[model samples]
Target: MCPVTVFEQDGCDLRVEWGLDGVHALGPHCAVLVVVDVLVFTTTVDVALGRGARVLPLPWRDERAAAMAEALGAVLTPPGLDESYGQPGWTLRPSSLTDLPAGTLLGIASPNGATLAAAAAETGTAVLAGCLRNASAVAAAASAIAEDRPVGVIAAGERWRPERTLRPSIEDYLGAGAIAAAVTGRSAPSSEATLAAVSYRAVRDRIPALLGGSISGRELIAAGVPEDVALATDVDVSTVVPVLDNGVFTS
Candidate 1:
């Protein structure tokens, strides 16, 4: 029992941790891993899945992303709206996929959510995309996948630019908390997980305002994409649980 292993939350039926470190720490011990990137990533997945699109999560700036999309015959989502590429296709922004058609295969990239998700998948456990939009649904789906085994929820917090260090965001905390709260009664949760749920419950009704004023939310608003923040804070409005299958998320 290395002291570091204590972070794995061993013996807990539900555990919560933050960022890529969390995935690596708890992924192997849990039967199911839920990645929550509420400001965008997982929210985007929920929006796309709800619209019937299959989403392939790719690490941000992965050189193989284009090749992988080509190999899978999926549309490689643009990194973001570029004036040079007028009317660009889907992007990491949740609202960008609102018109995604049914049966579309989209490869989406992210530094946080997708990176955490890919790391979790390496542990060979079931991986799910969780967010505020689909919190309850993802919790139910993850519980079913775990079948009483441990379920690890990773809040995919943003990276500090340049150095790329983890910057925990309140939005993701609430998103993870929302899912953890949904599983409160049935699963024995770690203290970390329980705190998240408690925090979420304390501000459940003010989620929209809290998210809008959160650092990540403010960033999106400053970037003129406030709708993304609004969309991500919908709070259990979607029932679609984007489960990762064969490296792609399909409801």
Candidate 2:
């Protein structure tokens, strides 16, 4: 057997890994894939879905994002955040989605979460968005969807700028841990998954503060969107589970 196969945690009912590489390693072996990008991507999805909006996850720099949104009749989110903070229009910021009307179709873009979700979708596995706001809900949904099959959780870590390499973000790990901890009773979790859950439980009370101080959260705060971090850290406030179906996330 290939060494890569060892990392799959094939015998476990629940698995966890970070980034797109995790998806490539574990997507094939799992029945459900949960993508966690707590800083923004998945958190935005939860908020939007809770308000009865559907989301189309798109790559951050994909030139086709607008065209694809037009083709799907969805509102394409702005690619840049030049003037999005505290504005009405949608970007990756979760606060802008507060008043999002029902039945809206939003094409949300991200470098981490959206990319991992799109990759997991290609594996033909069921993909669900998980984040701090809706961690418990997503965990239950993913567990039920798996139906005794393995479920893989992918933490969409931030990219180191300039080089754009993976920079594992604590917020994403904690979000993944939240979901994993929720489902621990239903399935046997891999060691990676267990560590995440344990870490989350250890800091469950300080999530908001930790998230605000995190590298990703600090960046957002410095960018004039502190509300984004605040909203993202609203643990268990949302019960929405945004599942990716046919290239869109609804309910």
Candidate 3:
């Protein structure tokens, strides 16, 4: 009865949904979108853009990845940090993008957020890469860009194991909530966005601890990327807002 995906067409002014399906259903409802992937992808984009680099987000890694980078004249993230291609100067990690020269176009690939970004463009809305680092700024920017257009905020959730179904990522939900709170302010938010905002406030005081112990956070720590988690949960530490334009994101 829900039409598989339904936009809760009622009160509030924003749509806060999750993953590709979220985009598919809610994208057209607004002309400005904020895509949040605090765990990594968008976080990397935020840092890169904060340093003045342009970013092109790719949905998934595949054969055309290298070709796309070359075509876009963007720097490719090395296949691995310790492998032969892991050049001393170039990287894909959010922490390492600071070394990239200003004015560079960085084409980044990720399994979730990046892909959702690409999909968001199809909605013909202005899309922005958002995270905890720039929540208030991104929300303010989105409010300005939206003007009269409705806004859609997509929390690009991580995959559930086994079937790899889209699972709500706590970090992403919190990130989305941060933006939602900023955007709504005294205004009422949709139920979804309200849920997100409440979730964020509940764990806001302990972001690092909450994320550090989350399933996704644990996986990143186990994989030796605790730094990424730290950088992402630093809350309001940045003002850079990565807005997607012409298939690229720039601050």
Candidate 4:
């Protein structure tokens, strides 16, 4: 379990940590859980939710996921970085999800963000998916749900090497920071949260360019999907907030 430092913010408590493991560690005290994956997953969720689609976040890629999707009458997304979801009403890229039919259901499998989201569902706290596009909305929704209860923001960082080790993702950090800052207002942020919030403020104006030049951004661009980067960096462009309940995300 990761060590959690509590912060008094907005006359309430708040906790921020990295990755799924951190979610497991601090989730119980977390009345509101915000999971951020700015590269694609959370961004896609934002877009899908904006279009009024119910998105089910599944952890890991396996044959079982297809069955779940079929049962939910939702389109299933493959767990690769490719731009396609191979379904009629779904796509992995956030920009593509904008045109989805309203009330559509989409089951998406992501290696990092979805995994943390799935795990966070078991904590009984309100679960929210956040990205650059909907950071303010997420913070508002989470704050409303949490009220005076503690809130936890989890940055679903990616692995660095072939082994499994959480490498701090700059985009996720900034996204989390933005949310944290928005949520806390003038509250005293913890050291880690402070760093993230400060980092986000520094590049608040250059979000699109910063994300485009990021490592994951470059990887996505190399994969022939630069539009995803643009969509993900459309800061505060969306007001729809996705809240997770019963294994699915809905606005």
Better candidate number, 1 or 3, judged by TM-score: 1
lDDT for residue 50 in candidate 1, whole number 0-100: 91
* lDDT per residue as tens, model 2, 114-193: 87888899988999999999998899988898988898999999888789899999999999999999974455778898
lDDT-based ranking, best first?
A: 2, 1, 4, 3
Where does model 2 exceed 4 Å of error? 1-4, 80-88, 184-187
Residue pairs in collision within model 2? none
Better of 1 and 4 by TM-score: 1
| Candidate 4: residue 164 lDDT (0-100) | 59
What lDDT does each candidate get?
Answer: 0.85, 0.87, 0.80, 0.81
lDDT tens per residue, model 1, 1-251: 33346779877889999988888888878888999998788988899989999988887778988898899999887753222123456777777788989999988777888777777788888999999989999999888888878988899988887798999999999999999998633557899999999999999999989999888888878878888888988888999988889999989
Q: Which candidate is the best by lDDT?
A: 2
Native-to-model Cα distance after best TM-score fit, residue 209 in candidate 1, in Å: 0.7
Alpha carbon deviation, residue 135, candidate 1 (Å): 0.7
| Reference-based TM-score of each model | 0.94, 0.94, 0.89, 0.89
- Residues 1-251 of candidate 3 have per-residue lDDT tens digits of 22423464345577698899888777766768899988878888888888888988876757787788899898877642223122456565677776767898987777678889999999887899999999999999998887756678899988866686888888898899989878843354678988888788787899889989988788778867678788988899999988888889988
Candidate 4 regions off by >4 Å? 1-12, 82-89, 185-188
What global local distance difference test value does model 1 have? Answer: 0.85
Best by TM-score: 2
Q: Who is ahead in lDDT, 1 or 3? A: 1
